[model samples]
Target: MATRLNPYISFAGTARQAMEFYKDVFGGTLNMSTFGDMGAPVDADGIMHAMLETDSGYTIMGADTPPGMEHRAGTDMAVSLSGDDAVQLREYWDKLSASGSVQVPLEQQMWGDTFGSCTDRFGVTWMVNITG
Candidate 1:
């Protein structure tokens, strides 16, 4: 397979819930592995890795922050979804901004597109852009 760039999020003991939320939002097949599955001494139920491959061809991976690592949210990056599929993109923006804080409402932008940004309930930042 060719090298691909995918967003991988790190959660603090909430990886399962966060990943499941993404599955609901993006309509995808989610595969997960736990610490126990990898014979780790940490919380057995903690997510070691989780991958969601959406029908829209989006791939998101996430995991519980390991014992020695820090799980920082919304400090450095944002996940962006952009395309000409207005209907589909609007649907995503609705679901994502429903329970979270909307940094920017989804509306027509000066760039000639509908754009918005929000922080999902899981504290992940998402930016959606729908081209005209």
Candidate 2:
């Protein structure tokens, strides 16, 4: 199998919801495992790990901050999505910006591309760039 590099996000306690929201945005199959499933004494429903694999071959994995772990928001990390497909990328921007804070509106950039940045409702930062 070929090696792949994907983002692994960490959530405070909303990994399940965040992963589900991503599934809606990217149209993918999500497989999740919880602490209880792993025989951990943490919250039964707290996600231990979740992976979302989209049809576009995008893979995002995430997990909740396990017990005794501190979750700090805005730690200089952002998940970036970039492609030449304007329609798909715009759709993602719309969904991601809804109910979230937009740091940069999706529009033409000086570099001749459509770009935007936002923090999702779950506090995960995202950047979407669409090539012109």
Instruction: Tell me the lDDT of model 2 at 108.
Output: 97
Residue 127, candidate 2: alpha-carbon lDDT: 96
TM-score of each: 0.96, 0.95
Clashes of each: 0, 0
What are the clashing pairs of model 2?
none
Q: Model 2's lDDT to the true fold?
A: 0.92
Candidate 2 per-residue lDDT, tens place, 1-132, comes to: 789988899888889989999999999899999999999986889999999999999999999989898898656589999999999899999999998999999999999999999998988899999998
| Best-fitting candidate, scored by lDDT | 1
Error of 2 at 31 (Å): 0.4
Each prediction's whole-model lDDT (CA): 0.92, 0.92
Candidate 1: worst 10 consecutive residues by lDDT? Answer: 68-77
Instruction: List candidate 2 segments past 4 Å from native.
Output: none
What tens digits encode model 1's per-residue C-alpha lDDT throughout 20-117? 99999999799999999999987999999999999988999999999888778866779999999999999999999999999999999998999999
